[model samples]
Target: MTAGRSRARGVATAALLGALLSTTAGCGSSPSAESAETDGPKSTWEEPASYSYTLTSSTQVLAGTFRVAVRDGKVTEAVGADEDSRRQAHDLPGEVPTIGTLLQTLDRARSEGADTAEAGYAADGRPVRISLDWDKNSIDDEALYTISSFEPTPG
Candidate 1:
């Protein structure tokens, strides 16, 4: 009886230790992937009818800085800021997207349960950066956009 009781106590102690370790394993750990993602895109942000913003995009297809001008909810003009961008702009002018389009991209990524979808905003509720990675394990599936020099034109 004494030996049996000792074995039971040892098993109980081991179980307890396992439970405690499992419970505290996540303590003091960094934020999880879910928490690292920003709170999606800002819903309050409204794209102006006519606006121009510098877009620095790092993606598989469109990878360059572009000076985009939107008028009446359309990209009326897109000027490349560098040699690569100039070539891209001349070759693929239709690929240039507007701010609204970028927001939509973020929204779509989040809804589709992308591995990474984060957005940084400015003080006045403007998006400064949008990062997206559809699949964490896939290559050339990430897109980063930096928006700056935003000016709303009088329509």
Candidate 2:
């Protein structure tokens, strides 16, 4: 074969191979493709739920709030404005804190205290609710407590 013709044939073969590989890969996952296209846009937190509450500690009086979105039963977002309060709570003598520690604390308080909070599902099975009059006075009053929560909304 002519050198020029051979080179053209090689190039064409490579292009065809690439196309075939891509198509094969795409065809292997129909459900994933449908979900990717049908689910619209993805959120950092899946099935986000929002909450607002208060945190009263020995050193500070903070209004805590947050938005938590879970996907596959795993927490995806946990943010709040009361960094001081959160830090203090984590620093408490027996507290083991983390990004999702606030929620655990709140849940514990709810279970042990007399707070009338409610939670429910929203769009796409996303849980949403609010807990008012919640208390976290375990920390000192002088500690810096801002509007803190797990997965807080931007001001």
The candidate maximizing TM-score is 1
- Superposition error at 85 for model 2 (Å): 14
118, model 2: CA deviation in Å?
Answer: 2.1
Compute each candidate's TM-score over C-alphas.
0.74, 0.23
Question: Per-residue lDDT for 1-155 in model 2, tens only?
Answer: 47785555445544543464356447644333112212112122332333332333222232233333433334444344377545544444233222234334434545656233222222332222222234333212112111223243332
Deviation of model 2 at 38, angstroms: 29
Alpha-carbon RMSD, each predicted model: 18.1, 24.2
- Over 1-155, each residue of candidate 1 has an lDDT whose tens digit, in order, gives 37775455445544543454356455665544322324554556789999999999766667789999999778999999999799988888888999988888889999999987877676566677777778876655777787889999988
**For candidate 2, what's the RMSD?**
24.2
Q: Global lDDT for candidate 2?
A: 0.34
Give stretches of model 1 more than 4 Å off: 1-37
Worst 10 residues of 1 by lDDT: 31-40
| Pairs clashing within candidate 1 | none
Model 2 is weakest, by summed lDDT over 10 consecutive residues, at 138-147
